[model samples]
Target: MRTREFLLQELHDLSQGIQGPFPYDDLRKMRETKRLTSHFKMLGDDDQLSADLNTYFMAIHGLASRLLTGNAEDAPTTAIHWLARGDFFAIFPMYCFLEDEWEQFPQFAHMYGSTKKMQEIVLSLLLTEDEL
Candidate 1:
């Protein structure tokens, strides 16, 4: 498994190019998001940090994938709908970590490592604009 700091670095690198909403609609079609949510559900209590990292990566990877779209009607907006379910509550994992008093994300500490950062690195897939 990658270290926590490595995942943080990945997220920091990811947030650099995002200017608006995350592309989670594309993520709804990605294998990675499915894997992320599945792994999230299977986590044990001791793996809260792992869960946090997974959520961050899920969102960031999605955003990075959409950076080149060059069009809006192509992907007008984004949402967290894929992770929300009637069967469960879907808190962004970093906020949940903070509520548990877990340390804030080192790379995102300026926002106390929450909220705005969540908006920064939201989810989509690797598909190019032409593919979408």
Candidate 2:
């Protein structure tokens, strides 16, 4: 498994390119997609996991909407806030891993040691984002 430091470093690297908030509509579509919800459900059978998943999705949607409609000056701050609170940074890599496209992004393959670890990270982020 990759060390936690490696994951943190990758996140830091990725964050450098984030200049503003993501499009609210795009995030909403991603969050509401049936495939993603089904994948989350398939990750676990527990109610806590399901609830966390829903809460996380809603949080992202809310954040995105707020940023989209709020002051332009607040975009960076809002983006950073949501980015820190959620696992949006890890989503694309996890999706690639789930879809067996890790080979297309060799760097992300080191983000998590295994598929199980990736799923756990996803769940953990979802459960914790609301707390932040």
Candidate 3:
């Protein structure tokens, strides 16, 4: 796993890079198949920053799906991937918000219970940040 400083620097570098009308078709396909490893592998380590951005994209997609559908099933499996990927560097806020709304998602109560430690880590991360 990357350090927080390294991940933050990568996010900053990605923010400075050329903005794209990026090709989403391949990514969308990979997402549908739940082939996240394949998707990340396609983005070689030479492009680590893009890989990081892709993880954030997945997290946002997860959050948006949950908010729109009000169903935990609608949440991206990638949410777990992002949680495992650097102690919730980019996905912390979304996870925290989702936890707050978890009461509306009784089906996910057991799963959420398993994630309590991650949620705590996310809270700590958020508290440590100068601004969220």
- Which candidate leads the pack in lDDT? 3
What's the count of clashing pairs in each model shown?
A: 2, 0, 0
Candidate 2 lDDT (Cα, 0 to 1): 0.39
Tens digits of lDDT, candidate 2, 21-121 = 32344324433566555654554544243244344444444433333344323434443354454353353333432454323333333322232233333
Model 3 poorest 10 in a row by lDDT = 107-116
Best by TM-score: 1
Q: Which stretches of candidate 2 lie over 4 Å from their true place?
A: 1-46, 71-132
**Tens-place lDDT digits, model 1, residues 43-116:** 54544543454564454345434443432234424434442211112354422423432222233233324434
Q: Comparing candidate 1 with candidate 2, which one achieves the higher lDDT?
A: 2
Which sections of candidate 3 miss by over 4 Å? 1-45, 73-81, 84-132
Clash list (residue pairs), candidate 3? none
Order of candidate numbers by lDDT, starting with the best? 3, 2, 1
Candidate 1: regions farther than 4 A off: 1-14, 17-48, 71-79, 83-97, 100-132
Against the reference, the lDDT scores of all candidates come to 0.38, 0.39, 0.40
RMSD to the hidden true structure, all candidates: 14.7, 12.4, 17.2
TM-score of each: 0.31, 0.26, 0.26
Q: Residue 14 of candidate 1: its Cα lDDT?
A: 42
